[model samples]
Target: MTTTSPLRSEDRGNASVTRLSPFQPLTDEQQRLVDSIVRFCERHSHDGHAALVMEGDAGTGKSLVLNTAFQRIQSEARDRDSTRSLHGMRNILLVNHPEMIKLYRNIAATIPTLRKKDYERPTSFINAMHKSEQRVDIVFIDEAHLLLTRTDPYNHFRQSNQLEEILKLARIVVLVFDPRQTLKFKGYWDDAHLRTLLAGIPTETISLTEQFRVEANPDVMTWIRALCDGHLLPLPAKQHFDFRIYDDAARMYDDICQRNDACGQSRILATYDFPYTLNGEDHFVQTGSFHLRWDRNQPTHPLPWAERPESIDEVGSVYTVQGFDLNYAGVILGPSMSYDKVTDRVVFHPDRYEDRAAFSGGGRITDTPRAQCQVMANALFVILTRARQGLYIKAVDPALNERLMLLWKERG
Candidate 1:
């Protein structure tokens, strides 16, 4: 639907959303930022080659802010239009956004797509928009952190397939991303040239600092900061965060079941880095056990069980659990195996280290975890914030926890 309209809300009086948020209202700061950016968009009024890079910590209302702004833009456009022509002018083309797997994948070179969900077709939805004369006034990239440079080692497809052309089109491109979530791949912000190229266009940056995720747990924030910066916080353990590092995940799972079962809701996230034949795509990664339940007295975990659903019962990874939350969350960090900090680079956690010697024959593929710690820390911070009431973290690797503690110690 190419309709320009503001997000309708019944509770404008509410300051910040808190109670089991399905729809989170923007914070005052976020709203102000959106107003300024939207004002700029209204003022500049360009038809081609313009963009806004929206980056922030997760839970800081990046998506909410953009959605609110887009709605406001629609309202403003409508207010100005006596002929309802501005609605057509305000046509927005959201490019290559990440969301529910089915809806996104179905939007292909041909719509109403058919195939197994494991399709590898559209990367940057921008290129498709650019080719169409459909008049997209603004282009918003939801997970812009997933944006890859023309030089990343994807190895499967052509580089010129996406991003560039769309950047060349559109009145304004709003990029909402957090590079911390980019543990598995390289994104648009990773490369300097791409940044420079995007910067070459008229751009302004708006950063969100107030975090709405991970409530009442400052330690989670501290650990995140320490991980991101080598202990660059006032106090890493400012408050108490219950996310613990357990030696045994199964035991933790049992404990979680027992405790949460009493309240009749227990969810488990079995982060098993295992080799499985689920349609035969090797998921080669380390896994662990994570459990979160409403109460702590349940006898056992439930089914539909492994993956999270909007029903608020079972739990899974970012894939299923995203857009939903719980009273208490326990994210089991399998291993601090994704990064290192000693050599000032992004290296895979030694535990999850895949031998790339046969391919690169060197350390080019694996960077020093230290180098990537800043990004990783940011990511961990975002993940930690996902909890509303309490957070329980259980890292399998003691050394990783120690490193985290060290980061806290250094923060002093």
Candidate 2:
């Protein structure tokens, strides 16, 4: 049986575009990578090379590095007009998310040097590669883990994985990926698998070690990792990190609203416990006293989920907020996640989890209950790490709430 396409097309009717602020200055590691790419492009103007893979976790500034390199290369191309040999060098940045592609195009429109044509969705770029005879000099793929394999519905025309097709279209391909961020069945890229695919080709790997997001607090990030790994324990107190556990979901929602009013970048997110309405209508996620709908409409360009006014009252799922960040995050742990008093651990119910697409086919190595639990755990881990300055959480299960409260009290 053939699977249907997972990409949902939305109607974005003439939405007014907003200009985003300029990117932050790159860290030392990010700058070095950018410089190396620039030098490689200049040195290999005639002969093409293989691919370069950069592995980094969510908050390691991979996006920053790619954007900086893009801008720098465009500026250099314009300045080297006298050097006719380098004038024809072409490059493009491919992102897997549609909303992100629209967001980047709107941002690129404001800058005089940046071209909107340089940004595209991965599927569109792949189609273009098949149609055109010309090969792009370099292709930078963000969120490379989201690239689909041959089993995906979107890969109907191609017989091979996305990485192979991408390598055929460009001399130098740069991929920024993290295995833990793979949230769908079709996302088949991992470090070990990618290395094996590029065995004969020249490949260079770089790992980013510094934490640039989540308020740059290593202790808070450590605690988050532990929590995802099933360690239901209290975190050590830190001076700058803001972590709080709330008994009431309504109160947590109110706090998120207030944080957005004060700081401008806060959002409420929840697990895939509630099924989205089938008739294209919004469905409310009612947990305790708190009630809100999932983001019904696609957000307009320029202002993304964390920045849009409509998103303030709507709850985001893992798909919408995976590759984004916010100033503060209010996370609701729904019925799918619960506390097992007998085992003294956090447990996941696969039946209660609504994201059936994640486990529909036998894509996972072992499609057992334990594997499903790990997938859900990773989803929560992604949502928890989205906040830069603060994190607020509400557990719907009373037993889980009491256990968290006791842990918090012990830390005090």
lDDT of each: 0.46, 0.73
Best by lDDT: 2
- Could you give candidate 2's per-residue lDDT for residues 1-412 as a string of tens digits? 1111122223122221221223556678877887876666666666666677778877777777777777777666666554644455688889887666766787688777688898987777888778886688888888888787555664453545777788888987878878777766556445677777788877777778777667745667777787777777566575576788888878888777778767656778998888875466878888766778886656445655644666777888887777677778999888888888988888788899888887654455555576677778778888998887899888877888888878777777
Root-mean-square deviation (CA) per prediction: 10.6, 6.5
The segments of candidate 2 whose C-alpha lies over 4 angstroms from its true place after superposition are 1-23, 80-86, 154-158, 299-302, 364-371
| Per-candidate TM-score against the hidden true structure | 0.64, 0.88
lDDT: worst 10-residue window of model 1: 1-10
Query: For this target, which candidate reaches the highest TM-score against the unseen true structure?
Result: 2
lDDT (10s digit) by residue, model 1, range 89-201? 44353523233232323322222212223222235344354457544576656555544544433533245424565565566777665666544333324545447667767
Question: Candidate 1 — number of clashing residue pairs?
Answer: 36
Candidate 2 clash figure, as a count:
0
lDDT of 2: 0.73
